[model samples]
Target: MKSFKHTIRALACAFTIAAVSTTAHAAELRLGSGFGDNHSSTRAMRDVFAAKVEELTAGRHTVSVFANSELGQAPEMVNQAQSGINFGVFVSSAFFNSQVPEIGVTNMPFIFSDRETAFKVFDGPFGEKMKPLFEAKGLVVLGFMELGFRNITNSVRPITQPEDLQGLKIRLQNNPVHIATFNLLGASPTSIDASEMFAALSQGVVDAQENPYAVINSFRLYDAKQKYVTDTGHFFDVIVFAVSKTALDAMTEEDREAVIEAGRLATLEQRSYAAADEATNLETVLSKGVELTRLTPEQREAFRTATAPVLDEVKSRLGAELVDEFLSAVDAAK
Candidate 1:
């Protein structure tokens, strides 16, 4: 009977220890983003990723998102994640070009024909190959979310031809390839963070900006006196979902796997939502009294041909071998 009593006591102690360990392992991560809370990217992290992480980990993990530059702009948030001050951030792929110029290869102007082709490339081996680039920068790329095709918006005038952009002061993301492309197209490009863009346009600090229709509608860029919007679709932008290597490394094996899987599923759903809403989002912009211009094939070709030199410039900046491999992968996807 004494042996039986001792065995019961030992089992109770073991149960107490296990419960304590589980409580100790529970983690609450903070996610940062440059987009508003209502944006698709933010919604994905909140509704999908956060929910899945809690469910997958059985309440052992949770993610709290800070949207709309609440943490900081893209570069600042990226730095925070790199330094382990923030757990993760969802930012445009263009922003990553500053750290890994090789990423610029993916931002080549007019390279992708449509959303389908773009999605194919990014969801394939080419996308897998780019993961290490972030890892090298102390970031673990979780998945790629869609920002969709970027269109040009200006307060100056309608951009119908390549020549129309001449003398226009355009605000571009701090991306060398983007600046080069705009310069080749005859616009004076100024690198500006997204948070500053609305005020820049409103105050005439910059006369033009380019972003996806969803972005234009969400940020209400039209209210900043943007009268003209052209479906230039010059570049397809991606929102990279990344976690700090520090945070990821600290996770248990099961928790890490859960995080990755949750990220992947969230990205897939976000892309589908963005793609499905493209037309409706464009309509929303038009309803706000903004003049929408659709480019004819010849007009689009003019912009494409004018900016073709940018490809060579990018190749020179971001190694020929890497660019070639990316192009080959894109071709294979085609």
Candidate 2:
């Protein structure tokens, strides 16, 4: 009788251990993005990061992606992540600027002359310098993706020169630096969320907006009756892959390392995908019947000349030292 009782107790202990182990092995993370499912950023997370994480963790951990702002707008998703709401986000530098104003330095007009130069700067020390800003705000900076160079689109008219942009009501991102920059260029700029952009354009709430060629194509802004597209290449924005620090801290050490590695790989792959897709996206926009304008060197320089003073205006807000470091990095990359 004594032996039977001991055997029963051991069996119960083993069952409990098995249950606990099974529970520990099943962990899931939610990654959210404002981009559509087909967007490269979303695809990278779904195809690269998700696969890599699953492989590294031996199926013990997985990622569920919410694309097309299914989770929420950038700001809301960012808040959810910070509050430990089982979320991660690929936030745009413009929106993330709300949390870390220093990031606005990257949004300065004409800072990067081309994609290669921009990539070199971001993948170098300057990019690493911005990580702690996110960490301090209770977010983990996983990696950076490309938002590509911003171009101008309008229902009003082609913007080939600084004078052409005059009197247009432009929809600017909810970034003060962007607002100020457009305002300086003589356009009336209004802050609007990306989710509401199509309606804003369709209803004539704003006559103009700016984004990368890929974004314009992905969002189908041509459907909003935007008649003209200008390759302004004004700013090279970054999409930051970030997760809640609280959520990261709760992960096991091995799982945490796996997550980090997945992010690094995904970022690298996504950047390449975005760069290669730019020309194709430009073609798509043209096929949609929008007039596409490629500004000459002189025409682009006119824009540069007009917005140059914005650097001085925004320096105090973004920290002079930080801006100097960014410019120095750009110079070095060149």
Each model's C-alpha lDDT?
0.89, 0.88
Q: How does model 2 score by TM-score?
A: 0.92
Over 119-208, each residue of candidate 1 has an lDDT whose tens digit, in order, gives 788888888888888899899998889998999999988999999999899999998888899998899999989888899999999999
RMSD of 1: 4.8
TM-score of 1: 0.92
Model 2: per-residue lDDT, tens digit, 1-334? 9999999999999999999886664477888788987788998999999999999988888889998888888789888887878558996888787688888888889988887898798889988888888889988998889888999999988888998888899998898788888987899999887888999999999999999988899999999979999988888888989999988887799989999999999999999889889889999999999998999999989999999998997788877888889899999999
Candidate 2: which pairs clash? none
- On the 0 to 100 scale, the lDDT of residue 189 in model 2 is 94
